[model samples]
Target: MTALVEMKDLKKTYKMGETYVKALDGINLTIKKDEFVSIVGPSGSGKSTLMNMIGCLDALDEGTYFLEGTDVSELSSSKLALIRSKKIGFIFQGFNLLSKLTALENVEMPLIYQNYSHKNRKKKAIEALEKVGLGDRLHHKPTELSGGQQQRVAIARALVADPPIILADEPTGNLDSKSGKEIMDMLVDLHKQGNTIILITHDTYIANTARRKIVLKDGKITEDVEVS
Candidate 1:
């Protein structure tokens, strides 16, 4: 299988007046197409930093990152933005939905960036919502839905673009056990449909749900193992 994401000698640093902090230090990793992988680490372990690099949300100080065979680290800002819009979908722990927009409208937001026609955006958004089992909640606002439902809407928004890779950051952090399980199940179903899924979380049990686990500590990967 082709590598969906590839990082080599990745390094990120932040200046703190007198000293510098390494968010990611000499990290190398690869995630292949249609693989479900989890990145687990304690707080400040640089997992989030790695996610930012993989998602093309931030630039690294050193190393090369290739997304779908394109060297993203060398791309211009405009090109990077285009890659983000077209190649990656992000799911956040906070559910990141606008309070005022209905679920359907929220899902349609990404399509607007792609300059899709209104009718086409609505059609794609409806299909995404239905795929996540939110067909009946399309008209409801985020506040009107439960925590799980709101997250479902977020998932719908992520999938609406039909991106090849899904990057989820702490996707189940705020939900109850039942809801978290449901969300994980939904993600598993998505992986089964041939999407590459990279999940970032601090929870071991949650990380185990993926077929492969990468453990990070102090800006380095300490373990990369395949689960049964």
Candidate 2:
């Protein structure tokens, strides 16, 4: 199977005054299409930095990153933005929804960026919400929903674009145990439907849900373990 993502000798460094902070030392990994993988580590382990690069939210200082066979390091900011908007979907621990928008509207926002017609955007947003089992709450505001439900809306927003890669950053971090499990189950369901998932979490239990685990420590991959 062709890999959906490949990073070779990826490195990211930040400058603070005269000192350079290495966020990612050298990460080499391949994620196949439709696979579920997790980046696992303790705090300040560079896992989040790796996620930032993968999501196109940040750039690497050195090495090559290929997303669906396209080199990203050489891409201009505009091109990178296009790729990020069209090919990657992001989920955050906080759900990041506009408090004023309803779930349907929140999901529709990404479609607007893609220039979808109003009818199609609404249709797609509803479909995405249903996929995450939130069809009935389409008109509800994020504030009206439970933590898990708001995150479901976030997932819906991510799915509305139908991006090839779904990059989730500790999606269940703020939820209660039951809700966290439910969210994980939803992710598994999406994975089963052939979505490539890249989940980042510090929790071992959450990380173990993925078939493959990449553990990071001190800005480097300490182990790449396959659990399934």
Candidate 3:
């Protein structure tokens, strides 16, 4: 099978004062289309660093990284932003919604970046909310929605662009158990429908929901296992 993502001897480092922190070191991995992957690690295990690199939110210090078969390290900053906009969708632990925007408008934001016409953007945004089972909550502001509902809106925003890959950072972290389960169910549903999903979480139970789990420790992968 062809890989949607491939990392070859990838390393990321940061400097603080006179010390250097190795956030990711010589990590080699691959994820094919339609696969759901869970990254599990401790708070300081470099999972967040890896997630940022994988999400194209940060650049790698060394090694080769490819997404959709394109070498990301070679792209210019502007080109990289274009690539990210075209290929990736992101969900975060925080809802990150604009307080002034409604759920529908939040979902419409990505399309605005893509320069889509207003009519088409609204159409697509509504469809995305419908897909996330939030069609009826389109006009609700973030404050008016429950935590799970807000998360569903976030997922809808992630889907609006119809990007093949979704990089979610601690997607279910802020919700209660019931809300977390609902969010997990939506993720599984999306995966079943052939979305490529990579979820970062510290919760083992949440990680178990994915087909494969990669455990990181001290900026290195300590274990890689398939659960399904």
Candidate 4:
């Protein structure tokens, strides 16, 4: 597999009151295309910071980050937003769906930024919703859906554009055990279908579900190992 993401000497620091917190400490890592990886850490372990760096949601204090060969570390916020919309799909723990939008409409959000015509967007959104088993609920608002269903909508929205990389941050954090397992299964199936998935979670079971796991502690990677 080709390298989809690469980071060398990655570092980020935040000033909290009188102390400086090192969110990422000289980290070096790489993720390949079609690989399923889980980044797991305890609270304050810099898991969120690392995900931000990888997702282009925030810049690093120091390091070189190459996403499919493009150096994104120093790109302007606007450029980073473009890269995010074009190259990455994000699934968050909170089902970040618009309250007034139906499942289909929510799924079409990403394509709107890409200037997709209304007809094409609707067609694609329906297909994505169907792919996630939400075809019957396309017109239902988020408030009318269950937690799992809402998350399915989010997943549909994330993949509607067919972005190469999926950055899922605690995707199942809000679901029940069964729903969480279902979501994880969906992610596994997605991985099998050739999407590079980067999952950020603190749950050991969830972390082990991936093909590889990277354990972080004190802003540094303590272990990088194959799941078996």
lDDT of 4: 0.94
- Sorted on lDDT, highest at the top, how do the candidates line up? 4, 1, 2, 3
Candidate 3 global TM-score:
0.97
For candidate 4, the per-residue lDDT at 47 reads: 96
Model 1 TM-score? 0.97
Q: On residues 84-131, what C-alpha lDDT tens digit does candidate 2 reach at each position?
A: 888899999988999999999999998898889999999999999998
Q: Per-residue lDDT of 18-81 in model 3, one digit per residue for the tens?
A: 9999989899989899889999998989999998888788899889999988898888888887
Q: What are the lDDT scores of the predictions, listed in order?
A: 0.93, 0.92, 0.91, 0.94
Clash pairs (backbone) in predicted model 3: none
Worst 10 residues of 3 by lDDT: 78-87
Task: Please provide, for model 4 over 1-228, each residue's C-alpha lDDT reduced to its tens digit, 9 standing for 90 to 100.
Answer: 457899999999999999999999999999998889999999899999999999999888888999999999768888998899888999999989999989999999999999899999999999999999999999999999999999999999989999889999999999999999999999999999998899999999999999999999989999999998
Of the two candidates 1 and 2, the one with more favorable lDDT, higher being better, is 1
Of 3 and 4, the candidate ranking higher by TM-score: 4
Point out where model 3 deviates above 4 Å: none
- What residue pairs clash in candidate 2, if any at all? none
For model 4 the local lDDT of residue 95 reads: 86
Give one digit per residue, the lDDT tens place, for model 1 in 64-160.
Answer: 8889899998898988888888888899999999999999999999899899999999999999999999999999999999999999999989899
Candidate 2 local Cα displacement, residue 210, angstroms: 0.6
TM-score of each: 0.97, 0.97, 0.97, 0.98
Measured on C-alpha atoms, candidate 3 has an lDDT of 0.91
